[model samples]
Target: MAGGGGRSHGLSSSRSGPTSNLLFSCGKVAIVRTVKSGPNVGLKFHGCPLWPVSV
Candidate 1:
């Protein structure tokens, strides 16, 4: 049940609104790894179970 909130600043400010709220259950380890070495880094998901309908 741990979470956080913050405000964006500078050129990275979003005019559309804030980022999406990520909701996850307990015991889930969320790892957001860097895919690139630039200002905008890509993300890859790991250890998440796939749904039958989505597959």
Candidate 2:
């Protein structure tokens, strides 16, 4: 029996092959953290490389 869930289409196609690169690649990856503002501050977090950056 074959496992079902993800589809083999678009970037998932075997022809495309496996990759470790990002789709909408950005300059560099950065560590996102929370601000110490009010009660929702100083919270460290992770985020995309192109969060608030524009090419």
Candidate 3:
């Protein structure tokens, strides 16, 4: 039961995006992603675990 209007500005501005084993601003676990198919393949990025994507 969440709306799509509570997205935070800080989440979108995360240039680093999806770091491995990192903590979000809310103290949650971070979801890191590795590029498997791109020029920057194998690159790791950091992201928040509690981002309101479907707020």
The Cα error of candidate 1 at residue 54, in Å, is: 6.9
The runs of at least 3 residues in candidate 1 whose Cα sits more than 4 Å from the true structure, single-residue gaps closed, are 1-23, 37-39, 42-54
Candidate 2 local lDDT, residue 5: 78
Worst 10 residues of 3 by lDDT: 9-18
Q: What ranges in model 3 sit over 4 Å off?
A: 1-21, 35-42
Q: CA shift at 25, candidate 1, in angstroms?
A: 2.9
Better of 1 and 3 by lDDT: 3
Q: Estimate each model's TM-score.
A: 0.21, 0.31, 0.36
Local accuracy by lDDT, each model: 0.35, 0.45, 0.58
Query: Is 2 or 3 the stronger prediction by lDDT?
Result: 3
In candidate 2, which residue pairs get closer than 3 Å at backbone N, Cα or C atoms, i.e. clash? 35-41, 35-42
| lDDT tens digits, residue span 1-55, model 2 | 1355774312211245544332323444434557658885786644455567676
Name the top lDDT candidate: 3
Best by TM-score: 3
Model 3 lDDT per residue over 1-55, tens place: 1356877534333457545344555666666667679798998866565544785
For residues 1-55, write the lDDT of model 1, one tens digit per residue: 1233553211122255545333234333333344466665685533223212352
RMSD for all candidates, in order, please: 12.9, 10.0, 10.2
